[model samples]
Target: METSASSPSVSDTPPGHTRIFLVVVDDTEEMRAALAFACRRARATDGRVALLRVIEPSELQHFAFIGKIVEHETREQAEQMLQRMAAEVNRRSGHLPSLHVRQGKPVDELLALVREDPGISVLVLAAGRGKEGPGPLVTACGAGLGSRLRIPVTIVPAGMSEEEIERLA
Candidate 1:
């Protein structure tokens, strides 16, 4: 696991305690909605947004050299994606978010981050619109995993409009 901040820490709250909204970053279209919701909520509540991008283990492990190259490239791509999203989060919330990159199963990494970071007060995800159902993270959380988490999980609907999210948040 690797973690870094996009800019100078934006999590410094007026009060000693900070409410960190954790959003898992991915390539899915629904991910935008989750990010938007989290940013708006963070802005409204004087909280901070944290993004976690989990890179699945490469299948090229059989070729040690190739695996190492693949791992480096994958991590680079994840960092780039996080940088782009961090700009959006900063624009919306007036604070740059802390970025995290991990290699493992998405659910496992997410759970571990939450357990390790007590400042993470909420886990926000967006439900998928595909026939495959509400995506793996949402499905996993709904299947009792959410109950095990110390923080509350917020699942945003994929089709929700920006205006609706702004109003709700």
Candidate 2:
């Protein structure tokens, strides 16, 4: 499916059931820990997963064509990545994962997604396990003392095995 500004989700929800979705912010890495965690939660709750990938804005604003091309490529990449992740979720949890591609700031786009789609139950992220600190998205969402997200945020730490993630979810 062609991705729009707010890309449509590839849903596999039961016809009558309202889908309660867990929105996981997909970044540079696979973040397998978070994916497994979200899938398990979705399976147990009879919901689904939405893998969201945001393309950070480029500094190249001189020409509109460059921005469009970049966005197109980014969307294609996100779709392929989400397809692989969806297969993994289906294999692990028997649920088809949905793909949501957006542009601009991660936190802002996430909040916009929340505002646009009430089906989203929670936002999941992986804590940066480096000396650098909790990842930008986590920190941007006010990870520590001041959590700003209206919806609950789940931050899975690094080194969590799939089994541990399964247990946590």
Candidate 3:
């Protein structure tokens, strides 16, 4: 479905029965772990899941000389990675979630997906990884999506043990 900047989700939800979740992940420990929890929780709640992995255009542009080659390669890699994560979740929770990968800004693409999918009632984000340094800061930046989206967003810390996260899931 086509989505505008003003409106991100494009589908309609039922009055009160359906719950759609938008879970964004990247190639990070926190993102994977958080999604694992979110997947389990979604399964228990009988909610539909949309797993999103954002591929930054800038990152792709930097290697423009091999853009075509790298783009397809990276996309495949990301797809495989997401599929594995989803598989793990399915193993634990018996839910196979939908997956999507887009080339653009992480925040912008995530917000757009949320707007386009009307079924989405909540957003689940993984916490930043590592100590208070550049890596953690960059990863944690996704938290801004919570404040930006109209739906409620749950942010899970990256450091949580799988068991700890599964309890909530």
Candidate 4:
């Protein structure tokens, strides 16, 4: 995959200049909108978007082989989804989003990635418009955890149009 100097792929970056805006990507339109917002912002900042999806770990101790197959399939699905998102980013923002798949709770994994990667500058998420309120990860991260985290979390409201996101970018 060819990379440009201004906007690099979301997954990889040049040494000493890897500013990242991590986006929590899920199977939701709200998540997609958040990703779009992150891509625009990253492009504006000469950074990249790390598109991350977390899958729940399988519980198949009764059948270890089946559990392994389930795990593999889950990872594949996540990859396919991320690839589609990357393509959208390329089409809309002229940048390829970096893809990541982790098997664990979203909040824990997201926070761990932030701790592990110093290049990550912010966590981007979409506020769920559901009556129950925002998703668990967004609520947890936006709660008291935000103060403890090294990076800030940017919450894009649900249904924000592409034009508004571009303006913010």
Best by TM-score: 1
Select the stronger candidate by TM-score from 2 and 3: 2
Q: Candidate 4: misplaced stretches above 4 Å?
A: 1-18
For all candidates, the clash counts are: 0, 0, 6, 2
Candidate 1 structure lDDT: 0.87
**Order of quality (lDDT):** 1, 4, 2, 3
**Per-residue lDDT of candidate 4, residues 1-169 (tens digit):** 1112233443355534756778877876678778888888877876667777888788985899999999888888887877777788777656666666787877777777777667677888888888868777677865777876898789998778878888883
What are the per-residue Cα lDDT tens digits for candidate 3 across 108-144? 7777876666677777776665675323323445545
Which candidate number maximizes lDDT?
1
lDDT of prediction 4: 0.73
2 against 4, candidate with superior TM-score: 4
TM-score of each: 0.93, 0.79, 0.75, 0.84
lDDT of each: 0.87, 0.66, 0.64, 0.73
Clashing pairs in 3: 8-115, 8-116, 9-115, 9-116, 9-117, 10-116
Q: What is the lDDT, from 0 to 100, of the residue 39 in candidate 2?
A: 80
